[model samples]
Target: MTDAVSYPEPLAHPEKRGIELIESSERHGRARDLFPVWAAPNVSVLNFTVGATLILLGMELWQAFLVIIAGSLPWILTGIVATSGPAAGTSGSVITRAIYGIRGNRVVVAFFGWFISAVFLALNWLASSFMGAELLAQIGFTDPVLVPVLVTIIVAAITVLVAVFGHSLILRSYPVVASVLLAIFLLVTAFVLPHVQWGYTAPAPLEGLPLWSAMTIGFAILASSPLSYSNSPDLARYLPTSTKPSHIIAATALGGALPAIFFTSVGALLATGIDSAAMDLGIESALLALLPAWLGPIFVVGVIINTIALNGMTTYTASMAFQSIGVPIRRIPSAVVVGAIGTALTIYLVMSTSLLDAVNLMLQLLVLISGPTMTVFATDVILRRNRYSGDDLFDEQPGSRFWYSGGWHVPGLLAIGLGAAVASLFLTSSVWTGPIAAAMGFLDLSVPVSMVVTAGVYIALTRLAAKRRPTAIPSIEGAPA
Candidate 1:
């Protein structure tokens, strides 16, 4: 009998995996596998809550759906980024060193990677705890204090456990998570769709921002979708080298956008179908009032499961982001650190009087950071035509092409700063309302302003550099020594 070759599980060597380039022999799995595995389960309490706020703010049903579509359109960039994984053979933040140089990438890894992940972990944990507590109460565990504590323990534990195991288990769990959540959401949709006030066109509550501000909020929501692309390569990096770019782009974009739209639309329908007070009670309460009693418990379980799925990914990605920041630790240990920090933040957020206010603030800040970076990175990818030297990517030796001015890509860094400043001028949020936004009647033009300014400056500077030193710009196919 012939001896069989042995292969280890993807997450088997967690410590061995941080930010390193994957060898061709080590890469496996289809690009298409990511569609159901990551996409469907991503629709969680956050998406529903974001959608609910639109209705609560008096956006008409059609308007809400249109905005969701508009916001979701940015998910395409995430899918595009996913295609970079196999060739780059590293996590998203690490891969950006090609554009920004290794030292320069630190700025992005801090803001886009570690910070965004930490904030999201806390946000997801808080939302999950809220839903889990209410679910427990409905099931007769009505001790207010005990329920919240138990929920926190259970949710936090699952997230940490899954993250520590790393990639294989996370991908495997998505199919199950997606199926269960989809079934439950479909049932909720069936219950709510019939009762939706399709013709309701009334203005939102006065406390809500006026029309211009609402539009800004809508764009901010849209920005979050694309911002996710920042770390998408972390998940996509496991695919085989031959995986087609088109396949990765299509799978991720379709997978993520579909469920997001479905759930957000469902929330919109529910928001208009019932009084806003029920929504204020929580997404579960809104569903429980409409869903049959028996279905309510099952749906709540689905909500808990969905929440876990989202947090699990957040914890895993956050760990990768931490590792990308030159942390001298294994992935599992880093994940433990993330879990501890995230848990503490979550506890603080849960005790706060207004979770919605916190969420709005986080989203606003996210747009200001993500919008400029995306413009610069996307432009870099287009300029290079996706051809990159794998060796040069990780090389930080003295003469490495990526070592622009002792590892700092000054132009790229400057563009990010300029973009953030322009974005802040029009930022309208619970965090800090910009003077320009107030003067412009709350126009909220932050995203566009950031994109235009950052792209304009970066492109201009890059072309100028290219003209001055033709040898400085390296093409992906191969570079002259």
Candidate 2:
């Protein structure tokens, strides 16, 4: 047998590979190493914002906790999907060729994957810019217009710098980042917890359909956080094939879910101490008001760092998605492009919209697409038993195994279409409420509806297709179970 390709190790260098298969020789790392990789990004002020938003939605403290746990469970699906990384030896964007066909996969990657990543990149930059601008104002650099503009540029530059350095640098840096963010957040928790009203509830608690609607909305908002990580395999693809699927699942799931749950719960607690009027000012301002003045700068710094950690991971996967979509660009340039576009979006949103309102609407709408897409991906992984041929997956010729039905896997496309269509009818948001949701007292069933329909339809269609054409389903023998 010929020797496997050698690649550079973790160092201060830009990652050279994009959607290309990682050679076995180049795959090195314990599956557990993924914990920090997933965790650090999620140790975010956004989670805190989410928690506060849940309280604002009229959920009692206990109800919010239930929503947080239930909503975050989707990370388990994300973890299951991560196992495909070691099995396929390629990023998630590339692996979808087996499910959607080479040509069809491009459309999904370009729109569903890359577009969502870019939106998230912009959101993270915007959040961090606000915090960075606050830090400047505290230090007497308080020109409202110029401060935000300058801060956004600085935040974008820092985030792009980390992403441009690529995979090895990200893996090496995230553990330290996770450690620092966790420590600082814990300190914030200590300061905020003493003031929490343990038995707090809305003075006029929601009843019946209103309560259910509130719960469903909260669930959709929280679940959207994990569902958006459908591209998680981009980070896990470099692990050795011998790595246990269980370990990868455990590490990735817990790494993300733990910090998310904790920080969100903290937000819930912090919200209990603030009046609705203070909360209307924004979660960041309310949170800072609760902390000692000395900790303000430190808290702002933590928020900026958290944003960098999250956006760095986002931009990395987005660059891979860019290359996967047949973009004739290298990884480094793709990073720059994604960064530039994200920066532009951030600037526009800052100037025109209420950041919190934009965030809420985006999260609600995001679940309509992200839920079905992730469900389809996770379902495909299970059907194949996590077995894929990295070399065969890259074949894009007309008669190649992945080129089913003239470069489209009809079942996958049809499933996603039917799923998203049905889900949209159940969507509930300030911007638009679907017909079904309106009739049902505005209950948001979009998240669960999309996932169930996508999985069920994809499975049924894939089986029927297999009966007609045996080669329609590619099989690889001796793959690790």
Candidate 1, pairs of clashing residues: 57-204, 58-204, 387-476
Please report, as a residue range, the 10-residue window in candidate 2 with the lowest summed lDDT. Answer: 472-481
TM-score versus the correct structure, for each prediction? 0.90, 0.96
Q: What is the C-alpha RMSD of each candidate to the true structure, in Å?
A: 4.0, 2.5
> What is the TM-score of candidate 1?
0.90
For model 1, the superposed segments whose C-alpha errors exceed 4 Å read 1-16, 139-146, 203-209, 468-481
Task: Report the lDDT tens digits of candidate 1 across residue range 58-120.
Answer: 677777888888888777777777777776777777777876777878767876666667777
Off by over 4 Å in 2: 1-5, 8-10, 474-481
lDDT of 2 by residue, 1-481 (tens): 1234356544756777777888877888898899999889888888888888888889899999999999999999999999999899888988888889999999988888866887798788777777677667777998866787778888888888888888888889899999998998999999999989998979789989999999999999999989989878988998999999989999999999999999999988888898979877767777787889888788888888988888988888888787776878877789888889888888887776655777888999999888988898888888778888888787888998788899999888888889999999999999889999999999999999999999989988887777655565632321231
Candidate 1 yields a Cα-based lDDT of 0.72
Residue range with the least summed lDDT across 10 consecutive positions in model 1? 1-10
Clash counts for the predictions, in order: 3, 0
